[model samples]
Target: MTTATRVPADPWPAPRASGPVRAVVRVPGSKSGTNRALILAAAADGVSRLRGALRSRDTLLMAGALRTLGVGVDTEPSPGATGADWVVRGGLGHGDGGPVAVDCGNAGTVARFTPALAALTRADTRFDGDPQMRERPLTPLLDALRQLGAVIDGDAMPFTIHGKGRVPGGSVTVDASGSSQLISGLLLAAPGYDRGVEVSHVGGRLPSGPYLDMTVTDLRAAGATVEATPASTGRPPVWRVAPGPLRAHDRAIEPDLNSAAPFLAAAVATGGEVLIPDWPEVTTQPGRMLPALLEQMGAHAERTPAGMRVRAGDGLHGLDADLGDVGEAAPVLTALAVLADSPSRLRGIAHLRLHETDRLAALADQLGRLGADITVTEDGLAIRPAPLRGARLDPLADHRLAMTYAVVGLAVPGVTVDDIATTGKTVPEFPAMWAAMLAGPHLASDNTG
Candidate 1:
């Protein structure tokens, strides 16, 4: 077992809002979309351009891994293009060399998605990540690959995929109850396999359904023929991909809606309004459920010309919701629920135990330290209205937990977050963005540009 070094930093005193906070926030491009696009682009037939992709730690790791596999991921903005544009030149047949190392860091996308990509190359690729990553389950995906004729050593992080320059892809059943990423990773690399791929889920209810939808959507956008069917009588859900060429194309990534959770929840917590510009009118991202969830929590959510606007409603209230489909939203929602007038029951998210940290355990421990009534149920969290106090909270190096701390700190003064730097995993400028949102009552950008 590789023991990860625990980096320590001074506690960040989370800023408290005096009154209603009003701002217009523009978050960075989607981390999910950026990483997924990077994978697809690396497998594309020609050069691919990605405009407005997130320049965060996770996306950077994905880009770096692709480059290690002999793919071209460069920063060459078009003649008139603005912001960050990544030009990927594909056509690298699997591995370019042997004995390569891929650092997955703490990004689940890199941990789960890159292994399949590594199997397509004829190189010795070793995948590893932070200490916490070594605990995440990769057996299902690895076993599925093994069934498809891939040589893999080890069942989790710090494993090696001995690429034979090709994968004899065929039908394989995976119990992806742990994560939907396990499924998306296989489909992203399926188009390049010798016989294509067919993935069937034979596990508990799949978590993060929207992420799977996003995968299929991105694959089709690249002109890859993918067919997905839900579970029928006496059958499991299946996704089939035909071996074909993935065309290179330019695409604009949507803003990270998941990143918007804290800011929007901030508005509800402080009895204010936040207008998030460039919010997609239609998106398959799980964060799309935010508006409806916010409305249920006594916040008014609507779409505007600028973007989605969420305003404080009558008052914050607890909610009973099954977050199996949107586990990403649970952390922030848990923070908000603690401040509600009643108790909240957030269920259907057992897989959260396998994330960067056991989010449920962390939430329960940290929130309880702050004098909140929080309990970890079998499948989710039960939070009751309680008086919260300022305390030094540990996010355990989880980005989402750091953001959750920020949301709780908005209404509860004197609270500080430890290891706040973890937010760099996705939103690199989360601290600055959080400070700016509380600095004034005017329209502002999160500096995603």
Candidate 2:
């Protein structure tokens, strides 16, 4: 995700806590999941309803993008409604629709991933976005699009796709080590192409492997044939998607477990308890590693029928591990590290520089403001728990950064989060939800039923 950012006028002063924190949070749908569902539903053989879909900036932008391309999208509750349902009349494969313009709006899913889908249409489509999007990694996916027979005007953001109403997709190889969206964006729309697609990763470590797995899992469930040579099998990765009719059906989107990080971490940081409902026993989401992460941080975790319940231990211990697979949780992890009783080291997350913000650098700067003993590492960070003091902090418009600091505010005092509204990117009602989770007032919760 990329955008030209500015300091918001009203910076939010994160609430200081008086005691142990307890709250039950039902996070909205996964931005990743909702966008993927919208894409799949758009190409399906019939109308599909997405229940429990996350309606936020990213997903809404995706829906808006699909709509501009002539996909029928209707929200049961309302547009941009959190925990909302969607009815989409699709089966309108690309290129047949009229010309369209897409505003990527700092969403990586929309920025790097949609060009391949756009190429499948015989429409004059233009893709444009904010300033930061121009600097994001998109060439890998765009180049792959060109090889697959789509006429593209530029190598990166602000490009145009001249859709032929049909793609002669066959085989394309790309090194998606920097970003998995390159591979996923191509594969998601591959089934619409005449010959389908065979995508092979050239080499090296693929950041966020679990996310790619999630994409593949959902793709298969939608009736597309997907075959892959696992990276763990000592071979380069490759995905073969068969051209076919996508099965349209109603599916309940899962809770955004990644967004559950901060609320869950508040438990670990404050020696309190927090429960995130509807935690899937089996999931491809990398956030599934949270329980393990909680244990490593010296927290007690219980898996019950309701959801995952976590409580802090007598003290937090440091950890040394690679977090590349679960990069989205890095901010929350860093916040915990700053308050741990011992030193901690997190490695294998350098790729975070390419995220919505330069996460690693942003974390370093923000944590520094909070007075943490943080040392920036080339691939990750090292921290020695210190007496953190509250201070005004800017997340640079990064939602993860904003939430991470809010977790810190639970244990510290007078911490403020600038541009807190930026959290609307994924969780629209985050501030309200967090406020509800606090002790004095009320707990803001969403009931899926």
Candidate 3:
């Protein structure tokens, strides 16, 4: 396996595109898919092989967390395989594995998903993360776990799960408005519970429906019976998982469509075209809406044999979008909005406030400093096109922000992203990929699988 370049401590002077760019970018497998697959595989019966699993900080953290709980997660590729293959040997019995501490490292999947797994172990599992992750929401998930008969201490990070070796799982209602991962966490770990679990979302608004759908699909693939009901006009969404044996199933993870957002954005920003090879014919990822979103922004998006191809249209224009389900893609889409010709209103993404950083505030403050007409609304951002100038951007160690700044840099020179290394959180080779896209032609990616 090729190791990614060591990220520098200084600001990254994002390279500018001299003209319209035409390139092919192959991003790593989905972080969401990889993490969920690891968790499912770890909780399954027998050994499973995961091909094209993302090898990034988040997925690594998840593997480490499962390993801490006595599950075997091997990262050795099989013979003739291209990229990394995670071989997970399941059968984590209800043993008193004593005490262990898991470092979440600002990965939402690590922070949100691991707690339920911890609830199944007889270990005194304590979960904590970086300073910023300490501020992200966990109470809703923690409280729901408590309802499922897991003894947990602390409201957020630095919390401990005192498991009695098995969770007395039952129905629990969670306010999952802040994050869909909260609900996914419970569902992923539900099969191991004594009574399985039935989760209901009775919060303000359940965000990221596609992510929840992704979770259900993975669970069903593992032979666990799952029933999901979407929210209606007055009824909240509910998910039910029946206790059963989860069979190990080897599969290839899809390329991260969310990670491909900025590359597509580069095409729109530069009046160029970029092809993302290996785009899945169908996916539950929220980023599946990226091509449609870009098309609305005056970009032509077409799916080919290679993958999804996005090319600049006649001109870039502002968009009025409700990004509730795909809020994670908002940062990169926001980059496109600022450069558009008209005003843009992005609503239904208030939950972004609790992500890696206060993304909404960060976007407003940073873009405002860059002379862009941007405002932080109650739910989203209101941006108007203006003359943007290059400036040093602070991503606050947020990976999305780092990529967002890089997209802006393609159009506006002198843009530097502080802590550009933070992109390692999801896209380990983001800087390299950005450089390759700027150079044009077929771009190399970390995963050739």
Candidate 4:
């Protein structure tokens, strides 16, 4: 049996203050959208191509899993060789091959989404992950699939997904206490089943609701019929997707506003100016609420067709907001609260505990080490903004925590984030991108020209 080990945090010392910092940055593509698009494209009938897909560990794992299922996947540089594009030939069927093992490499998205996609194939495939991935729960999704006649091994990582050829899709009530990915996975795999699939929530409150919307949107874009209904007494909210042959469509993934939130928070916390290009003005992404929250805290934010423009205020103030829909942004938002002049309270984040790490505890523990007043409640965090005394931060092996604390370091000198390499799992160019963005006046001057 392989035991799970915590990845040691690598400390990143506070960046040396250069002159006035300003830059227009093109944030990386959305990992969420890219993975969803990849899976949808893989399940579609014809060829679907994606431009500016995030080439991170998680997306790579999805691509590799698709390849194992016999999907023709290719990567080609755009005409100018500036950005990469993916060409995917979809239409998956049962392979006569033996059990295919997939290594998701700490990507909860790929780990959860793949099982449903794998069920579409007649082959027996096993989904496993790195130590961290194993620690994450797959029971909710597995239970839902099992209810639909898919044979899945319960209580194990690297569990076998026995495809019984075709699943009779019917109504399933999924307990989303663990992760919304459970619901998202079932919804993505629903279209390929024999009968239409109807998923309803069971017990726990659904966190990350926007992410589920992203799934529904992508599923519809791939020519699947999906209808979302409100929750009733006995039945949970129902998401119905009809079984059909999927058609291919070229998809351009939206910008990763979740990834961009930290940088935008850094700009607000440190009294700096930063612009994230290609950000969608209207987005279901919970991260889009940052601009309004930042403005509420006295930061200046303007929305342009190009993207979002953010400038820090004279001083930051505390805010109390319900973040159930956008739990992913909770860490960075919590980091922002650390620099506020007053105590900030963030609620409706109980689901944060089940992510890549126990984000609520991890955030409070690490931020407390920096001499900030933080408390992790059952539902969310309460933070008192004060001058954070620079200290070594333990990121607890979570990519979001590591990256979020790095933003904290921008305002508090001498702060360092440990286990920094884990950032590569989601944002590969983190250090270099941060360094280049923080190059201060050099980047600012270039952007001005």
lDDT of 1 by residue, 204-287 (tens): 989999999999999999999999999899999999999998999999988999999999999999998899888888899999
Sort by TM-score, best first: 1, 3, 2, 4
Q: If scored against the real structure, what TM-score would every candidate get? A: 0.96, 0.94, 0.95, 0.94
Where does the lowest 10-residue lDDT sum fall in candidate 1? Answer: 75-84
Weakest lDDT window of 10 consecutive positions for candidate 4: 440-449
**lDDT, candidate 2, at 237:** 84
Report each candidate's C-alpha RMSD, comma-separated, in the order given.
Answer: 3.2, 3.5, 4.6, 2.6
Residue 352 of candidate 3: its Cα lDDT?
Answer: 91
lDDT of 3 by residue, 1-449 (tens): 11123344778899888998779888888999999999999888799999988888889999998889889998986454324889999977556776899989889999998889888788999898888888888999999998899999898789999878888899999999889999999999999999999999996878888999999999999999999987788888889999988999899988899999999999999998899989999899999999999999999999988899998999999999999999989999899999999999999999999888889999999977789999999999999989989998888778999999999999998898888888998898789889988887743332352
Model 3 lDDT-worst window of ten: 1-10
Please provide, for model 2 over 1-449, each residue's C-alpha lDDT reduced to its tens digit, 9 standing for 90 to 100: 44465746877888766677777777888888889888899888789999889989998888888887778998987354348998888865443755679999888898766778777667878998767667778988888888899999988778899887788999998988788988999989988888999998985578999999999999998999999888556567889998988999888888888999988998888877788889998988889998899898899988888899888888878878899899999889998888888898999898888887788888887789878988879888999977888898888767899899898888888898888888999988888888877752322322221
In TM-score terms, candidate 3 sits at 0.95
| Regions more than 4 Å wrong, model 1 | 1-7, 76-83, 94-96, 441-449
- Model 3: runs farther than 4 Å from truth? 1-8, 78-83, 442-449
Candidate 4 Cα misplacement greater than 4 A, ranges: 1-10, 16-20, 79-83, 232-235, 440-449
On lDDT, the stronger of 2 and 4 is: 2
